[model samples]
Target: MSSRRTLIRGGHVLTIDPSIPDLPVGDVLIEGNVIQAVGPNLQVADAEVVDAKGMVVCPGFVDTHRHTWQTQLRTVASDYTLSDYGLNIRLGYSSFYEPQDAFLGNYAGALEALNAGVTTIVDHCHILNSPEHADEALRGLREAGGRAVWCYGLFPNPKHHPFRFDDFDPSWRLDDARRIRKGALASDDGPVYMGLAPAEVEKPAFEAVAEEVRFGREIGAKVISCHVAMGGHSVHVRPSVTTNLGRALLLGPDILLVHGNSLSRHELGMVRDHGAAISATPEIEVQMGMGRPILGAALRAGAKIGLGVDIVSNIGGDMFHPMRSALVEERGADNDVLFKNDQIPRRLEFRCRDVLRVATMGGAEAIGLDSKIGSLTPGKKADVICVRRTSFNTMGAWDPEATLVHYATPNDVDSVWVDGRAIKRNGALLGVQQPSIVEQVWASRERLERQYREINIDQLRSTKGYQRENYGN
Candidate 1:
């Protein structure tokens, strides 16, 4: 019908815009890639209508760091500690997965997110062992029909020895990153953007990582993300005060640090001074025993903050669980107003909606996409998701906002649209068939697992440092 003039009529709209305040009873008029108008209603002329009578329309959720390829390997690494998890699951099998398998897994993962009402995802695809692997992952993410950022990585999320600094070619990596953006990112396509993840910050020599970061900045790759917050096996023992703080000292406005927990007050201030963003994966922090402490530190430092699923391999995948867990855990620890004054401000009292902002607007800022996406501003892209207020998960909720944070599930998402195109409508995908995509992903995982059993994995248990130890565990 009319791509430029789709009317999302009749909903309690949460614009997430302070200027407009709250459009409790509202309608959004989307024209092409941007929102044409947003208000109660002006006219019902030539526009094609998507009835939003019983929906809570808000800006789409933005997942800052997610390993989309791991959708097939879910819970397979459940028993393995971080070290063993990589040794047995990620590198053990993921390294062996065909490019086609990655495509299938990414497809399934993107659709799952769309079905769950996440309109945008930053797929930090680091398993780029080959150029084809990178391209295939990009293809799957784009074709899956949602807004995504293909964050090409220099290192595969290692399950073994350090897939560290010296293993990759920074020159080749730079060219590949450039190629991905020029060939893929430059395309006037739907819902997909391209950037680069610098892999690990700690293991890489300071100069090498700094060069990569500089290269990314030069290419106008607004976001330069690092897996810095989760205190890895190495960080826990020796503890890096220099590199940890030194890295922040080297950062600029476009950079983003993920899981930034260990930074002291001065270091936090350093990050904030740079105008950088922090992505905290609340669920995974608790699971991996990384200590859930981002909320207090980042805010206190005055840094822009966002929430990520980190990787889809755990409860991190869904926005609902992460949002709930972030607020509940933070508030649980704060206890009272006295604690709030110390950590969070007494005025805000560590809000649920503030976390929602981090999940959306703040996330966009982290990725350096605030101007184009994230919020449902008039001129901004119509990247939006509809959570069903009428659903069993949200019914009889006198308070719309609290019920959404406390009760809404992935199933409550009825529709998702990215850049004016509908990806998931009525709980199903648009271009890709969910069942078939998931089947392909599952079949690929089976084949990979079988191949691993035949070729390796028995030796996996023998690998030095491959055990159930954590930073403390």
Candidate 2:
């Protein structure tokens, strides 16, 4: 290990690991990228001491799925439905992206998440319009210095795109995946890993889907993420693609299904039995009329559940919003079912801590990073965060987990560390030029917005673009 050592002391620690009990005043010793010890007190001679008094020390939050390149378009789709998103983002703005735009967006998004104490992210990058786009996105992640899985995308290019694709071959996607797996991400033990986000079932036939899965497996992808059973009615964006793929996809433990808003109990059970996990973006799913959030349903069906902020284009990027949304949505849904039978719910089946677990451990498990992160274990990676409870909204932090999940916001995050490196200290990103990042994102957003207007936004607002593709032949 390097000579660098950090000692975080004098804080209320919530380990989140069952093997260790919560400590009212604990100390954590970190050496290099891994934690050395966690206890009531630790005496270390050659270490930089960080006083954590009046703070809640815990594991950093993990987001299983985020279209991070869409960070610059934050809140642009505040009122957009699933169909509207497909029309505007998938087919419009996404078509105009240059590699630099992908870099700035991904880099800015990574920094944004890090500033908010999110140490790990699964960047579901479907805007890989070119080979250079893939390189730029991975570079952005590495430059931003966060743990991530760059899920290489295979979404088909739209015919109406202004970008020249006469020479673009779909086969290049496979070659790029191979290159990334063998070259850019040869070792799976780094802070960033390689994963695959295959094209939706419609674009890729059953054989293609099988090929993608086999390719991912052959390359030992850390995770194969898919958006399944989401939205009201759209084959291209949110239809029950998983139901169509069924067991033929050969999903294993490496697969992580996102959304699943419309997934049946049978599908959920199949995922659970196959050791696959589900990442539910409760806020976006609820906002887009994608039926109820599947937190309770997935949990009851014995599937591992995780939380994600699906899109910054519509909802906030903080994990708190999704956690809170999941909790209340499930309780409200339960109450509705009880009232239909003329009965009242005696109590909520899920607690605040449950959602917090979904944000931390469940999320880590979703991306297969739980053993190294998600909890402040002695042997785990030092992906830790400290939330100052002195803020007006989080004062009197009698309950650590409750205050974190319900009351705390990104503003309360005082310090964040990933792999023993301080990324955010004293509520600001360390060594990051925020103004430059902002400037780049703003420029990219302006260009994307100007280009998107050419695609006729009014038409997108008036109708669903990809809904017709749902007609199964």
Candidate 3:
């Protein structure tokens, strides 16, 4: 343990813990990696003091799912649909990434999260082209000094032309994943621990996916995440992903299903019943033609729901976008129903505080880290952020949660801490060589784009894009 103590003083605090009342002007006392006390007029000797006046101090944002390894390819798929992304980034650019490229992407991405007040993330890293790639990705997460669940992706990397089923091999990935579990990520007590992102339920046979889940449990994975029922032709298999999993007795509390846009009410109930969680990346889901977001539906079904950025390749790496999108989209959907019925709305069903909860507490719960890091409660890890409430966009806001949900941007993040260590202060990330990382990321992007440009678009489309018929359930 560490003996360092720091007191963040005089700020509007949103604990997000129902038992702990919100403090209009409060102090958070941190000793070592844990929050020791939280209340008004906290006084202690020899504790370093941080002035949080004019700030909204709260638990740091938790991103339930993000493809951190694609940081260098940010906005490359800005106008692309889900199919376009699958063909280009998933099957094309990912193949050209080297081990060093993975390191640069993950390191830069983790720092980007810290800079944006995201203290914890579920990094769904699927660019593991080689064992060296896995090592470098893990190294990047570790070196960034952030809290993350590095979910080892079990997706196959398309190396050969035609990208046939024959190229889909799981032996190498399984061995490497086990090696990572036994090696660097053996203990869940570390800042960065292990999770598993198995192959899409639609892509592989049910038995294969079940075995992967079994293996994940065997290795003591903290979370088992998978993309399910994304809609817009994303699911080619029949009977639904949740149905298959439920029948197989594979659904459990450890499961986190992303983008359940097309899931039925029964399916949502199944998820809730099994104690599984849902991560809604609303911005990307709507933009990529994955149908409307399932936030409202999941909420009604009483499923544990959280927000995610999904991929920076298409959207920003900030929690604000998803938070606002989930709220407004759900409200809009409800209003549309009222309008069609020729009735006036009584009130908004989803509120700002609700989405804020989804971004922090719900996210932590979704990823199985709530006990350690979600709310501003004593004995929990001191993962906190101070947002500038005095900024032009946020000034004069009556409700701090409303200001954050509607106005606060990543630029307004004034300070951030994870594990009681300040990773960002005074509106800048600490201990990061940002310029060097950016330069290296750009270099990697150039090489990747060059290789990507050399590939024949017609051949790629024929082989990887529209060749879904060849992949059977």
- What lDDT score is found at residue 258 in candidate 2? 85
Residue pairs in candidate 2 whose N, alpha carbon or C atoms collide under 3 angstroms: none
lDDT of candidate 1 over 1-473, digit per residue (tens): 65568888887788888776567678998888888888997486888888888788889888887888888777775555556665665556666767787787787788777777777887878767677878888888878777887777876533323233224344566678888778778763446766678856565556666777767776766566777756554465333532444554656666677777665677677777777778888877777766665876687678877877866654436787778888977887666545656755445477877778878888888777788777878999998877787777688765556756788888888888888888777776676655766677778878877766664555555444233212223
Q: Estimate each model's TM-score.
A: 0.88, 0.93, 0.96
Give the number of the best model, judged by lDDT: 3
* Highest TM-score model number: 3
CA displacement after TM-score superposition, residue 125 of candidate 3 (Å): 0.9
lDDT of 1: 0.72
Residue 210 Cα positional deviation in candidate 2, in Å, after optimal superposition: 1.4
For all candidates, what are the clash counts? Answer: 6, 0, 0
Write down the TM-score for model 2.
0.93
- Of candidate 3, the 10-residue stretch with the lowest lDDT total is 464-473
lDDT scores for all predictions?
0.72, 0.83, 0.88
Is 2 or 3 the stronger prediction by lDDT?
Answer: 3
Structure candidate 3, residue pairs in collision: none
